[model samples]
Target: MISMFVTDLDGTLLKNNRYITKEDKEALQLLNKKGVDITIATGRSDREVQAVFKELNITGHRISQNGTFTFSKYNENVFSQVFEEGTSLKLFDFLHAFDFPCLISNFDNIHYAKEIPMAQTLQSLFKTPLIYQQDLRNRIEQDFSTSKFMLLGETSELLSLEKKIISLFDTDVSTFLSADMCLDIVPKGADKRRALEALLNQTGIKKQATASIGDGFNDINMLAYTPHSYVMSSAEPKVKLHGKKTVQHVYEAVDDLFCHNLIL
Candidate 1:
């Protein structure tokens, strides 16, 4: 029987990167009743996840900010990482040259995009207000530690930027395409796989007893680690390659496991 279920929000759980679907809500509610632990692992920060959790009126463990932070169901911080002050400044300076909308996140998310459309798009996706600011560089220069940096632009443009980032800061930074137009650069060694490992250690849940589902490049490593893994059918073929199975929706996967008696 599966003892735990981990999911990515934007694509795998949340419909269209906004809100939870009724089918998924009921599926997770059923799982809660069945005593199967639920986890939401995403590139979103814990703060954003908190808003989502309140909206769903459900509590679950979170592996947020691409594993830069892990919080228990009780809200205890189990693992956290921040870019070094020096590294954060350097990364900001280097990335700011690009014309894409750049947003910085620490424990709190800050959206500072001159482009109204891009800001609106992200606001709708995450359902967060535009806490507009123009002095991000100043804040970093003043020794502000950051958790992650996200760039919004055309898919092709961001892909090129991702390659450049990997080549230049290969060892110090981890990059993922969270969405088609979203590229997230996080501290090296801070990723879903590492955070999931930490979560497993903290919970004492064996790897074999957990099931994971994702639909983005960011979720690839986590999916790879769980033998009982799933990916959304809507995921790109390249992203789908990591999962052991595929489902049309979150409920489908949950229902499949129940039908096969994988969950007790």
Candidate 2:
């Protein structure tokens, strides 16, 4: 009954440097030909997702910004979640207190408080420019449409930050680890699960009829949202449990869904 497939980008579909492998491209084309819906769910933004689509020469729905934003196949806006009043300030208090390197992300742009080498390195990797705003707090206050706040650090440090974020905000905020090293924070109702639920509603696709594949901790909720979840072989052992099964690569997951008729 699977009619839709959602896959994460980094470390799952893209082999390296935002490049899609031949196997993945072929698998996606097969799915397209089979009249199955294919979408990408990632922590990246609209620009990054668009670039990925162009590189792969395929188009479908997109769940962007760790589920803060969703777009239709033809590049139409579906929905966007933004921080509530005073929420950004509260998060800024913690970011300022911890002296953590943070980024203020909107749908199409990333703004930084100041110039940081690590942020610059990420820019190089993303091939996207970072907007410098020395007074980011003021900027957030002026425009409350900020999608998510992200903190970058080592894996252990990010885990510690995750604990701090959860303890500080409790259920008032939603937080998860992305890329295995960064902490992505959003409001309580903004996450992959919520976004996917909304997408299913839009497409009239049942949860049981959808298959999801991902590798990062942020992807776990989306993986668990469906019965036919597949985690990549490169994922951590802890992440594997979220999915019904594991595949050596994204193409294998697709093949299982289409060729083998296997749900697990």
Candidate 3:
């Protein structure tokens, strides 16, 4: 009865190298043949997500920026949630207290506080322009309107910063740890679940017909909301606990869920 397959990109769908495995590709093809809608929900930007789709030959609606934006593979915008101008400025001021690097994602570009090692690493991985700026506040105000903000640093530092930001903002913004060293911020209540709801509303798909797969903490809300939820076997314990079932990998689940029945 599952009509939609919602997957997280990093560590869930894509391998560590950021490429879809042949097994995953075959699984998706099988799902398509069975009339299932395969979609993606991730913390990446539209540009990054599009690149992934092109590499995988996937055509589906994508929920990006941890649900701040939703668009289709055909480059159509379906939904978006942007931070208020004042909120953006407040966050920028607060982040200035920390020395760790950060990136601000607008509709089309990524702006950095300063050139950092992590920025360079991500540039090599994503192949997107990384604009270095001395004054992020001015740069954000002038060049682009931010949809989401991300911070990269050690886990302890990021956690400490997350606590402080939440205490100060007091629910003014939503915060999530996508990885051990990564913190993603969006407007309060703007999460993957909210984005899933919006997508369901737009496509007239019921909750019972949806399935979500993920491998991280940021994906918990969306997994909880879906009726048929799955977590990767390689996911952290907390993430694994949220799903009704766990699979060894994206392809294993896809193969079992869609292909095994074909020969019978």
Candidate 4:
């Protein structure tokens, strides 16, 4: 019996407008009332998850920062991972070479270079304030460490950048395309699947009892880890292939899953 529902936020749970529909909310509420654990696993930050919960009026654990951090709705930190300072510095140099706008994110805060135009764009998308610093390398070296770094730009450019970073960093870094225009870099093996595994261990939930839903490439790993997994109908072809089922919308998927007794 599936007793846990782990969903991604952007395109799986949130509509195109980035808000949870009434149907989606009701479905989650119903699952919650049934004692099913409903959680969000996304490439977003803890702050972003909190904002999403507030807007949707949903309470559950969260896997954030592309699985580098896991915490509950009450802001308790359950598990976290950080990138090494030297490795992060090397990565910063590589990203600087590409001239792509980037965000240096830790489990606690998101820091940005002063000159990155895309920083404001991402801030607007996340509806969160940006923490700007002049010397990004020094800032990363001194004040913060990261579980992940997120880059925003066109797909082609980001992909090329990713290849270059991989060649340079080798096995020490793991790279993935979270969105068409978003590239995420983390320590090797730090991903949503690992995050979910950690969450399951901490909560004493069986892997087969969890259902994961997502709509983007970064979500693929988590989707594959759960027994019952769903991909949004609108997801890219590659992402859709990873899920056992696909739905046109979040509520429809949840409704079908429950009504058909697909999950216990």
User: What TM-score do all the candidates reach, one by one?
Assistant: 0.95, 0.92, 0.92, 0.93
Question: lDDT tens string, model 1, 5-76?
Answer: 998999888887787888888898889789988898999878778887777678889898899999888887
**Candidate 3 lDDT tens digits, 10-124:** 8888777367878888787667667777788988887777777676676778898899898754556778888878888899888866887778888787788766876667786
For all the candidates, what are their Cα RMSDs to the real structure?
Answer: 1.5, 2.2, 2.3, 1.8
**lDDT of model 1 at residue 177?**
92
After superposition, which runs of candidate 3 have C-alpha atoms over 4 Å from their true positions? 73-76, 259-264
Instruction: Give the TM-score (vs. native) of candidate 4.
Output: 0.93
Q: In candidate 4, how many Å is residue 28 off? A: 1.3
Q: Give each model's whole-structure lDDT.
A: 0.86, 0.81, 0.80, 0.80
Q: For residues 1-264, what per-residue lDDT tens digits would candidate 2 score against the true structure?
A: 778889898889876645788998888877877777888898888788878777767788899889999987866677788887587888877786776678878766988785677665677767467888888788778864788888887879878878888888876678878786678887777877788888888888899889999998889889988988999888888899899989978888887775667433
**Model 4 over residues 1-264: C-alpha lDDT tens digits?**
767888888777767636788888888888887888888888888888888877767688988888788886565778788888888888887777666777888766777774775555566667467788778688777857767888878899888878878888877888888766889998888888998888888888999888888888888888888878888888889888899998877777677677778666
What's the lDDT of the predicted structure labeled candidate 4? 0.80
Q: Which stretches of candidate 1 lie over 4 Å from their true place?
A: 113-117
RMSD of 1: 1.5
What does the lDDT come to for candidate 3?
0.80
